[model samples]
Target: MAKLRLFVDRLSQPSRAIIIFCLANGLDAEENLVDLGKGEHRKPEYKAINPMGQVPAVDDDGFYLFESHAILRYLASAYPNVKEHWYPVDVKKRAQIECILDWHHTNLRRGSAGLVMNRVIAPALGHPLDPKAASECEALVKASLDTINTLWLNEDGSFLKGSSEPSIADLSLACEVTQLQFLGEETKAKILSPYPKVRNWLDAVEKATSPHFESAHEKLRTLAAIFEQRRESQSSEQPAAQSDL
Candidate 1:
């Protein structure tokens, strides 16, 4: 069988999730970098692979697939070696996971990705920061976190939906929360500290995935440092500019 080809950028939460899943499961796969920073994902070559031109797309032989959740489900079913815990065969269990995945896009993704993009990524990409949008997104993020803490997670298990082991849904949401690492420590804590259960589940997911989780997030951490430095520099300049005024 031909190895699956994953086109991904680690900076993307979904992309990192896919990469971590493959590594954790020991799947036979090849990673192809789709550098979103350089607009590589927008090129004609990448568009051919994924008409939507998104990171975290996969090519299983000639079968092309986009959308991280779909890719995860496909990989779990198509690969014989994948552990059932990731996507259980029991109908109810799988449905529970699916419920989380479906809720994730509108609730979690918007808030998490929106906050990151508005606060850090947008300015770097030449869009000025929008404080109003950022505030709205942050509110959504906190609401989503509250939901996760009170609803999705339970004392019966460490993973999402109270599963004993981590599932693709767990990896998906964990990576989304990981994006908060790029925010300044004070801001990150402000957003996350209210939900201790959410934080614990995140740690559990990382531990379950192990070294692969750290490896996949390496670039995100590097960029987080750079973003922090940039924020500090801007802050120092702001004081001087105010003094001049």
Candidate 2:
């Protein structure tokens, strides 16, 4: 039997989510890194796997899949070993999880991804930082966090939608929050400070997911360290440049 082939770039939140899911479920999956920075995802060979040319596509034997959410649902349904809490068999429970998943794309993901792109990625790609755009994104992000704190986060449980265990929705959103590691520590704290419940829920998800969660984020952690170092170097150089003026 061919192992599930997972093509991913760990720096991507969704990719990390998929990796963590597979590892946590103990699926026999082969991880194939697709370097988005080098445009490997756009190559014809990779396109043959996913026409959209995106990282985090999967080939489970001959069946191919793209989009992290779809892939997660498929894997949970396909593999009998996957625990029910991750995506329950019960209709009501599943539907509740589905609702959160749907809301995530337009709300949490939009704000978080937009902020990361504007504040971190755009500048790395040689584009000037857009403070106005980033500020807009930050507002949306805070709104989304408030919603999660007040709505989705259950008082009865540690997970989303009142579930006692972590689900696919939990993993997805938790991974999205982890992307804020790219931001300056102070900036990240300011964004999260108002929502202590959201922060606690994130910690619960991490604890539930355990070693796999941390392992999957190893690349992100490494890159974040480098990003911080680079930011400090640039800041130090700025004063010297101004002094010479």
Instruction: List the global CA lDDT of all models.
Output: 0.90, 0.88
Which residue runs of candidate 1 sit more than 4 Å off their true CA positions?
240-245
Highest TM-score scorer: 1
TM of each candidate vs. truth: 0.95, 0.93
What is the lDDT, from 0 to 100, of the residue 217 in candidate 1? 91
Candidate 1 lDDT, tens digit per residue, 1-245?
44699999999999999999999999988989999999999999999999998898999988999999999999999999999999999999899989999999998999998888887789678788776887799899999999999999865899888888999999999999999987866678778898999989988998999999999999998999888887777779786541211
- Top model number, lDDT: 1
User: What's model 2's TM-score?
Assistant: 0.93
Query: Per-residue lDDT for 7 in model 1?
Result: 96
What does the lDDT read for residue 33 in candidate 1? 95
